[model samples]
Every structure is written in structure tokens, then in C-alpha cells.
Target: MSATTLPIPTDAGDLPGLLWLPEDRDEPVPGLVVLQEIFGLSEYVQQRCADLAALGCAVLAPQLFARLDPPVAGIEDGDDVEAWLAEGMELTSRLPWERAEADAIAALGALRAHGAVDQERVGLLGFCYGGGLAVAAAASAEEEDRPPSALISYYGSALPTLLERAARVEVPSLHHFGTADAFIPSQTVEEIREAVTAGGTREQVRFELHEGAGHAFDNPHPALHHAAASEAAWRLTAGFLAETLFPRS
Candidate 1:
């Protein structure tokens, strides 16, 4: 499904977002707020949103980089992996963490309030930088008593710092990480697993570690994409979202 421009209302102002709905929509459907990676809402991110919509979800992806001075809508991948990584990191550094977190929460609210979305069935999904932001947003939303039904994060780069609030995020959640991720070490991933899953006591939380996968394994870039891991992770994600967000009776 193709995505259309959506303006999300926030305290600062309306942020530009992209919304994708299932083509066979006959009634209100479950909603998902997809946060962007450090590279912003690039083509890969939009394709993922389309994938979710194809699964019968009302998907909304907020353009977090739009808040920047130049308002970058997306970043193109280049041959130089190191340079591209540095550029993405620089862009993310320019945006304040607090602002991005609040914007993510606002996007969730906007998605929940969408005409085609069933408010109670709304969830959060994120990748890379956004993966960590989803965790923070879920925690904040829970504190406000507006928790999303489900949460999914793929290689959340900021998770190491957000562990303190993990307890507040009590919703059903699925976390994906690479065992070989250089950006986030294996030890750190284990720590994240411990925090988010409450030392394996939270039966509702599912954490998957993909072996032989590095950071951004799902990205289509030659340097980052791990085809096997990406396919496996997507399979797990689809199943998780199916059972948690839009289960059939």
C-alpha cells in the first residue's frame, strides 16, 4: 500500500508523518506508530510501514527529522559505509533526545486517534535509533495511563541508557537484537534483555537474538543487511504483531 502525508498534532506543532492503511479496510483496524532510524524515514523505513499496512494495520511513521532546521525527510544510503554512518549519527545528535521522545509519543496519540484505527489496539514499532525511542515512548505513555497495546524494537541503539525506565513499560513487547552488533555489544544486549524482560520473569516480553547479524541487519544496504537474519526477524515480528496486536479469533 502507498503512504500518504499525515500531519500529527503535538505540543510544539503538527509534525509531518506518513500514513498507510490496508486496502481492504472495512472497519477500524489496529494501528501502529513506526518510529524512524537515525537515517530518518528513508525508503527502507517507508517500505516497512507499507509491509505493516499490508498486514492489516493502520501504520503511521512520523518524520522526526522534520523538526530539524533543514528538515530532512530521509537520507540516502551511499557506498561509503563509514561516512554514511557518521552522517546519520551527526543528524541524530543534532536533534535533542527529549524532543524526539515527545514527538514519538505524540505520533502514537495521533495514530490512536486516527479515524481508521481502533484506539485500544494501537501499538508502537521502531528500528535502530527509533527502537530505543519506542521503549522510552512506551514508558512515558504508560505513565500517562495511555499505554500502547504492544511494543517492538529492532536494535535500539539508545537502549543502554533507557534501561532505568524499562519497568514502567509493562505492555506486551518484542525486542530484536543482533548477537554480533558492533553498535550495541552482545553484553549490552544481554543487559537490555534482562531489564526489559524483568530478568526473564515477564512472560509477555519476547526477546530474540539473531546470530551472525550486525547492527542494522535489516537495512537493505550491502554493508548492513543480513538476509537470513532479516528474514528470520521479520517472520518473528510478523508473528508477534499478529498475536499481540491483530489476532484473529
Candidate 2:
């Protein structure tokens, strides 16, 4: 696994970012932005970058919390997720959410300048808070300048509140949710569907609900993660990215 740390410049602030590339690959590759969960860019998020690198995609993960507080390096899902999150909020709360969104966009520009990325074929994938941002960022882009060919969101619970904007998402999208997500109730799912439909982006939205799962179902910890749901979502995400970003000519 080969990786490096880079910086992103935005109007709000400068942010640190991580880039992972497969070993012995000298050719330009499609880029994929791996947004972190609210816990910050912990080890799991870095590991996901390596995982995507193994798939031959150049992966970049921006440390959105850098301006507020540099988060811990490795944190797995468990009872402690909230504790780590509290630490993160201390720094993040200092930075306006609007700024973070701008930083997310800036990270893409930085990645494009690295010379190893296919600018026209970028993709964005995020989990938890990042998941909702992934949808919003992709949707917010104008068709002629969109950064992502595909968007993947895992348990994008906050989206319902921002549905007015999220509903504008027109890129081909794959969304995974736990049927039992306490964060996003079943009734809310129906409402989200209505919003997506209202946006007229229904053809671009593909929603899937996993049975016997809950929030953060994709985390690896058995106590906090649902193995079946995690694995299932991974498969769907893989297929979606392959189809959208690495499609056959």
C-alpha cells in the first residue's frame, strides 16, 4: 500500500488530506474521494483508502477536521465512537459546516492537480455524516462541471433534513441503509423517497435497505457492525463504482 498526505485550500480554511495509490502503477487512474464519517478520518477510513487503492483507483480522503482539531489516527467502531466524536465536535464545531463543505470541494481540485487522476471520471463515496455530504456535493454540482460520475452514501440519515438540496442529486447514485436504522426511521425513508422523486432524479437514485441491520451497519466491529450488511453494502458499492467510474469503452 502506498499513500501520502496532502493539503487542500478552501475559502474557509486549509485542510489536510490523505492519498493512497497502488504500488508500481505509473499510469493515470480514476480518482475517488473517500469522505470520512463524523468520527473523523480514523484508521478505518485510511484502510478504506488502501482497499480502494487495491482496486486500482487513486483514492483521496480529506481531513476536514484539520482546521478545527486534528483527530486521532485509528478508531474503530464500538462503544467509544461517541467519545471520539465528542472530541471531534470540539474542533469541528469551531469550523462552520459551510466551510467544511467548501473544503470537500477543494480537496477534489487538489487531487486533480496530482497528475495521477482522471479528472473527468472522479467518484465520491462517504459514510455517516460524510455520506450525506457526498450526496449533497454531487448533487450541488452543475452537469457540465460535476466531479463525480457516481455517488455512494451509507446510512445518509441527515439527508432528509437537507432533502431540498440532496434531492437535486442527479448523478447515478447508490444508497445503502439499514432497515432498522434508528437514526432514520422507516417513515422517514418514505419521505426521502418522495423527496428524491420530487427532485426528478429518481433514475439516478438507487436506494437499498438491508434487513436485520441498524445505523453504521458497515462498521467492522461485531458489537457495532453488522457483518452481513457491511459485506452486502460493499458488494453493491463495488459494482456501482465499477459500472460508473470504470465502465468499458
Candidate 3:
């Protein structure tokens, strides 16, 4: 699947994004707005967009780290994982949470407006930092009467602070977490699951916990990757999206 660079309009300016469309563009398909991790729109993220497109959805991932001086795009976890992680964290710190949330919502709007997308069937997916931002966008969208049809979040780092809002997210949602995540405790993950699932229909929320897996288990980096966990999470995510947005009659 080939991806094209496009500009997503935002209040600040045009946010660069990678767009992937399904091969059968004769009809508009479900659209998905993907949020980038702290490392920016790395190869892993772009590949995920392609995977989503292959699964019969249009995907767009905006550059949330574009606020940085040099505009970080893609950074791999080199030999010095700590150094790269720190660089990514620094880039994330420079971006205000409010602005990042707005940018994410803007990306969703752009995807919803695209001619190749089924606006009523659009959704949002994000990882780590983007995961948290997705939650904020969901809340905003709900208030604006433009909520996504579904949401997928992987180990949202700021979920603890957004629990109240999460409880109000009525859309079908799938969340992935690691039991051994050093940054977020297992107890916290449990709390997040409870909060996000609260007040929703019985089948509206799903949480998958990977045993023995740490943070960023899907990154494919030796320091963080867990093949088993990543595969399981992807399977769950793919099934969830298919059922929620492309149900078979």
C-alpha cells in the first residue's frame, strides 16, 4: 500500500500527514485518523496505516511533533534506546497538550472530510502519547456531536488524568495495555479499564492486557518489542475495527 504526504489544516497551520487509501477507491470506505507516538510518525506508525488500509479503511497520521524546532518525523530506537527515548520525550514536552489535542481533532476532521472516506463511519487510533490525545479528541467530538464510530488506544500514558472524560466516551472502544509496563503500573491499567468502560453498554468497551509485556511492545525494537503481545493486540484491534466499522450483513 502506498502512502502520500498531505497537509491537514489546523488552527496553527497546516499539519503534515501521511495518507493511505484502500485499493478499491470506487467507493468511500471507513476513515481512521491515527495519532503518532512520542517518537513522531515513525516507520512503525506508517506501516500500521498501511495495514489499516489493507484491512479496508482509509488512514491519516498527522505530525504532532511538528511544533519542535527541527520538526522530528521518524526516529528509530538505535543502540542507545535511552537517548532516543529522551529525544522523543523532549520533542513531546515542547508540544502543549492542548495544542496536540486540537491537532488530533483537526486530523480527524480532515479525514472525515476526505472524499475517499465514509464520514459517518470514521474512527480514531493512537499509541502512547497519541493514545491519550485520542481520548481528549473523543471527548471533544462527543461534545461537538461528531464522535467517532470507534476508538483504539494502546497504553495511553495520560489516561489516568482523563478517566472522568473516558467514562463519558460512549463510542465502541478497544484499549491495549501491558501488565509489566514500567511507566504505567498494572494497578493503573486496571483503573483505566474500569474508568473507560464505566457507563457504557456491555459490549461497547474491550481491554486486552498482555502478560509480561512492557511499554511499546509493538515497536519491534529489541528493547521494547514483544512479538507475541504485538500480534495478539493487532489481531484484537483488527477484529474490533472490522466488527465495529465494517460489519458483515
lDDT of 1 by residue, 61-180 (tens): 999999999999989998998899899999999999999999999999898888999999999999999999999999999999999999999999999999989766889999999888
Measured with C-alpha atoms, the lDDT of residue 198 in candidate 2 is 66
Tens-place lDDT per residue, model 3, 59-132, is: 99988887778787878767898898998888888889999988888998999899888898999999998888
The TM-score between candidate 2 and the true structure equals: 0.89
Where does candidate 1 clash, by residue pair?
none
Between candidates 2 and 3, name the one with more favorable TM-score.
Answer: 3
Candidate 1 CA-lDDT value:
0.93
Show where candidate 2 strays beyond 4 Å: 24-26, 69-92, 197-201
Q: Give the TM-score of candidate 1.
A: 0.98
Worst 10 residues of 2 by lDDT: 69-78
Model 1 ranges off by over 4 Å: none
lDDT of each: 0.93, 0.76, 0.89
Candidate order (lDDT): 1, 3, 2
TM-score to true structure, per model: 0.98, 0.89, 0.96
Q: lDDT score, residue 170, model 2?
A: 69
Question: On residues 73-148, what C-alpha lDDT tens digit does candidate 2 reach at each position?
Answer: 4344556766755764555556676766677777777777778877877888888888887777776564337557
Candidate 3 or 1, higher TM-score? 1
